[model samples]
Target chain A: MPRSVRVRLFATARLAVGRAVLPWPVPEHGLRARELVAALEQAYPRLAPTLRGSRFLRNDRYLRDLDETLRPGDEFAVHPPYGGG
Target chain B: MAVRLTRRPLTLAEAERRLRARPGGAVVVFAGRVRRDRRRGSSVVALEYEVDRVPALARLRALERAARRRFGASELVLWHRLGRVRVGEVAVVVGATCPHRVEAFDAARYLIDELKTTVPIWKEERGRPVRRPPRRRARPGVRSAGSGRAP
Candidate 1:
């Protein structure tokens, strides 16, 4: 099986991407979180705006900063600001 | 359960019941309902709520613990509806039971405030075009929100 990151989109991000999840390809050596996000924006221009105001998670845990590295098979989730009552 | 994220309508009655009244305990429940507000020149018919269940429930449980520690709450109910909530329908309920009224109210308030700011929940507005009389009327129907059911 090929190495890939599972990118989960929610709410506005889902709307922008037209899907809830994506198999984002990444090098086997892994890459910085920032690089992955930039690549996504380049691939899906409509997602750029939503990405600007979103929080990132890896394996259900929030990323402290974009410096964190994303390895193959990691689940990356994008959460926009909450609006629930 | 101290917290819930469900597709069914949330209710203060259920929340109060979950608290299980005590002889001297005071309960304070805050229920938030959907409103028929206007947006983009259209009337909002319903709000479509979505959630990232794993993180959302974790945060709710965390808030439950915080409420108990901060306000001396003996019991709590934090329930939120997922999916299409029609106008005037209850969308969320957060309540607490404490030995006194002050602590109960404070705990309830804190849960709601924290839940809104921290939970992985979001809502999108579904609108109905305002009828201008001359224009053809839309069919009297609405689609369910996402994969969740509508009431």
Candidate 2:
């Protein structure tokens, strides 16, 4: 059986924290970071507006698209524009 | 006091004190301040700074580590102040302690230069561009991501 992937969010992404862990179902071979975001938005309609305006990161680096396949133990995040001081 | 970010006021003396060590031979300090330009009045208005802390800290730690490895410096300090700062107030301060003048000076300059292009901090011009679409402010130690450097 394929192991379930763990996703972590920070800053703006943490808004979907109604539950500590969401049982994210992944594709048989796993999905990319962007696809995970799409699935997350579908599951949590309340976060739709924020989902449109956010950028996603797999690990600490920014991901260019949603189709990048997720690897086991890969961490994901959604970030909002933070003003730089 | 040292190697930290603060939302309150920045004190130069405190920064120097933090960087100065008993056995270190030299201490270097660099303070970035607000200056009046033609766009503003004779007196400068307040300067506001915003930062994305997560990425900012990541880059800061990277830069500091690089400096330490390349220079073999004894110690280093970084302080950044946010919110309404008046003219001549310190925005960012960097201090390095080393055994000689050359390493201290070189590391300090490198840190400041990298900061301007990389650290993900933005500035507001205050008077102009207020009504325009919210633009991303320029940050130290950062480039547009295709420059091929670590910004």
Model 1: per-residue Cα lDDT over B1-151, one tens digit each: 7788999877777787878654337988899999988757799999999999999988899899899899888889999999999999999999888989999888988999999989999999998887655745455686434535655
Itemize residue pairs with steric clashes in candidate 1: none
Q: Write the per-residue lDDT of candidate 2 for residues B29-66, one digit (tens) a residue.
A: 89888776655333346677756567678878888898
Candidate with the greatest lDDT versus the true structure: 1
For each candidate in turn, the TM-score is: 0.88, 0.58
Interface RMSD of each: 0.5, 5.0
DockQ of predictions, in order shown = 0.82, 0.16
The interface RMSD value for candidate 2 stands at 5.0
lDDT of 2 at B39: 51
Highest DockQ model number: 1
In model 1, where do residues sit more than 4 Å from their true spots? B22-24, B133-151
For candidate 2, lDDT tens digit of each residue in A1-85?
4355666543344555554245466766777776777778887786667678776666666678777887766666555544333
